[model samples]
Target: MSDVRKPWLPPRWFIRLAWSVHRGLYRFSGGRVGLWRPKPGKWGAMRLTTSGRRTGQPRSVILGYLEDGPNLVTMAMNGWGDGEPAWWLNLLAHPDASVQLAGGSHPVRARAAVDTERDRLWQRWREIDKDLDAYAALRSSPTAVVVLEPRAGQG
Candidate 1:
């Protein structure tokens, strides 16, 4: 939140570059090597395709997620940058989207987790990553915990 930078935090440019490389690798692999299912007490990667808020076109990204029963939870952390991620903004504009997992693809609707649910999910994340709070503090404000709920007819 402060202008003062933390010594341990990676620079914004490096973070953005790393994200680009990650996405590029996923795209280059044709999705075969990019995603996985979340195992107990751990996180996993998935491909989320959201409609572009402004253009109404598909935009996809690989994001880390934790399965919460029938729902998938991730953070709109923007690589822990100051602003919300574009995909999150897209979800806010158009809640309906699709996620590609190691098993298959399915429709999902996105929303921000709030109150006690958010606290619980955040605690879960802290269990997975001990530095969750430290990294989160690098942000100017609270990051929204995003929930991707399965749409009707899907388990």
Candidate 2:
């Protein structure tokens, strides 16, 4: 397989379009239609709502995730594009956030997986998606694997 990454990424317009549609479906179905993992994958999906780093307003995005015991693991890949996703950047400024699943929402704190844990999570992603490396190669920098830990003392 070639290491070239350009062809692997979806166009920016497509990304925006898909996101809009997903958000609409999620809202219209009352957390049923677009709440599961993305197509062709077996993981879970959650609406990660974060406070905008600059504006301090709420920002939400649907992401595919895997549950690691009590933590939710997700990759910060913007459709394999070169730029980092806004939600990940937001977490850097303010790690506290909330995740809404099909069942309910929970308070959570986001952090980057480090060292061996990062490696393990990245490998697990590849195991789930055989073309993960090719997609990662599309990015100019390494994609971050974010872990969302449930916050304490929240009902």
Candidate 3:
């Protein structure tokens, strides 16, 4: 059997330190956060908004995303313990969400890839970060590969 405990969220001090670093970098880059890219060909930070599954309130998160063809795919990187991140759960319940890409902000529909599609998408994700293979091994539940498609009139 594998450990299934929830992954520890970053400590408050760590979060504060990271925020300070990000802010300083943003200022140095003339308000652009491009300096924080984890890997080449990957967008730095994306502002994604999804409706709360139960509360119906709007929630936004700054997440790393990769463009796959005309769609954008984001991994639920809550370590290998947490099955899926809360933002992903919200998007799953309400596919109508919004995202801010490199160019601009726009609404999009979210869908969790299934089966072979999921495998292919995961492979692309691995290409971006080889370390993700470790996380992939720890997951007993399906890791969601979320696809964000541009909404009509916003292509």
Structure candidate 3, residue pairs in collision: none
- State the weakest 10-residue window (summed lDDT) of model 1: 1-10
lDDT of 3 by residue, 1-155 (tens): 24533344566578647755765665577546633333564545676889999999998666677777778878776545546778888987888998765577778999988889889988877777665666566667767788898888541
**In candidate 2, where is summed lDDT lowest over 10 consecutive residues?**
1-10
Q: What is candidate 3's local distance difference test score? A: 0.72
lDDT of 1 by residue, 22-131 (tens): 88887888877778888877899999999999999999988999999999999999978788899999999999999999899999999999999999999999899877
Per-candidate TM-scores read 0.90, 0.89, 0.72
Candidate lDDT scores, in order, read 0.89, 0.86, 0.72
Residue-wise C-alpha lDDT for candidate 2, range 118-141, written one tens digit per residue: 999898777788778878887789
Task: Identify the candidate with maximal lDDT.
Answer: 1
Collision count of model 2? 0
How do these models rank on TM-score, best leading? 1, 2, 3
Q: Which of the two, 1 or 2, has more TM-score?
A: 1
Ranking of all candidate structures by their lDDT, best first: 1, 2, 3
